[model samples]
Target: MAINLAILGATGAVGQELLRLLEARALPLGELRLLASPRSAGRQLQFRGETRTVQAVSPESFEGIDVAIFSAGGGTSREWAPIAASKGACVIDNSSAWRMDPEVPLVVPECNLEAGRARPKGIIANPNCSTIQMVVALKPLHDAAGVKRVVVATYQAISGAGARAIEAFQEQCRAAANGEAVDPGPLKGQLAQNLLMHWSVDEASGYQEEELKMVHETRKILGDESIQVSPTAVRVPVLHAHSESLTIELGRPMDAAEARTLLAAAPGITLVDDFAAGAYPTPLTAAGTDPVYVGRIREDVGNPGGLQMWVVSDNLRKGAALNAVQIAEGLFA
Candidate 1:
């Protein structure tokens, strides 16, 4: 059944990717609506070989919308998601607003597409971008060997911050090359040649909000509250595709070759593991791609029974827009 759909925050980075995926993917489509803030109204964007003008979203904009995908900031989602849901749209949100909400299901289609069917509030929360890639890589392992703990350190891309952050990083790169002062516009500090742990801080736990999201969201999506996740999220000097080094402890001992075989067969995963030949996934290679690239699979020698691997994916694609689209596809199509 073809359905009517709307994109909230349609001019932003993830929103733009959503448009591209809608054009590229096979989603039964009836009507497509592009929406944004009042200031962005009248802007023209190309879709399905047609020009669609961005409209300043109003209550009536969602009147007949079957699904509303939001990539705006948290405040916009908190304010508008429910409104859209009330107007008969299944709201798939790409912000932190409803992620931890008990009433809302935080979903990654590969890990838990079934959780999306019982949306009491007519809203499904997209898991954090970092969380989305990690869980997708690990879920198969968890199903096969029962994952116990995960210690992850992320090398995230600046594009995860926003389009403005990408522009800022480029400017900082030019300045660094010229030995001029680098100004971090939305990034807060020099990111041209430097790494940062700059997501919002939680005063009590002292963990960046990004790290905390991995810990909790991983548990929620995997349906295992006892699974421990220690995460360190660092913003790296990359343009797209977020990468992570994960050390996983499982219930039963699983060797590298076994883990490799499992990941090779997992859905939404691309295995490029042959480290002896110097093949592994990287941000540059993963840019503009969909699959979560998994490589460098090996046994954790220190932990004896644990495994270690590297994961990378286009944060804007699988991490945000594509995941939301997949949810709507599974639910409606």
Candidate 2:
């Protein structure tokens, strides 16, 4: 059964990845519409061996569309998601706008695809990129041992910021290599050979918005509001993929071997946990990949009975575009 599809923010980074996944994945396709802001209206994108010109988004863009994937910013999603839903399209929005809305289901297909089926607002949200990968890695253990608390420190990539941030980082790197002064564009400070906690901060909570997303979004996706999440999100100089060091406390006492067995059999996870050989998942290993890579599964020495691990995934792929496409696949295909 072929379905008509519309991609909002078609000229943006995640939107372009959505186009590539649509071509590579098994989504029965009908008519495809590429939409963006008026500035990107005339630009052409290549898909399925044909050139598709992007059109400016408007009320009529959702007409006859079955599933609309919104990769634009939250403002655009807040404005257009309901409009798209009203026109009978199931909207999968990748933004912070609707994830916390009780009416909208925040979905990571592997973890909560069924929650997506009962969307009261007809909008399904893609979780924060950082949250998406963390939840995916935690789901299997969570189900097996009941996750009680998580302390996560994220090393996020510049690509997670946006396409422009990537260019800025590259330029900064070049400048640094030449012993020249650096310019931080779309970033607070130099990201080349540097680290930053650059996400918007809530002065009251003293937590960056990115870190807070992990806190609330984790509870929501795991369907346990009582679960505790302590997060610290930092930006690294990496070009792609986000990495996290997680210290998890579970309900029951589970050793590293037991956790490894469960994760090895879980969906959307690839284990590279040969610690003796110094093998562990890393940003470079996960870039351009779809699966959440987990390694260094060990009992937390400090906590005595808790678990620790390293997780990594491409922020743009599994973290954003690929996750949205997977939700659409589960719902429509």
Expressed as tens digits, the lDDT of each residue in 1-333 for candidate 2 is: 999999998888788778888889988999999999999988999998999999999999999999999999999999999999999999999989999999999999889999999998989999999999999989999998899999999999988888788888889999999999999789879888889987999999999998999999999999999899999999998988999999999998889999999999999999999989989999998998899999999999999779999999999899999999899889898
TM for every model, in the order presented, reads: 0.99, 0.98
Candidate 1 at 24: error in angstroms? 0.7
lDDT of 1 by residue, 193-212 (tens): 79998899999999999999
Clashing pairs in 1: none
lDDT value, residue 168 of candidate 2: 87
Candidate 1 accuracy as lDDT = 0.94
Superposition error at 268 for model 2 (Å):
0.4
Evaluated at residue 326, the lDDT of candidate 1 is: 96
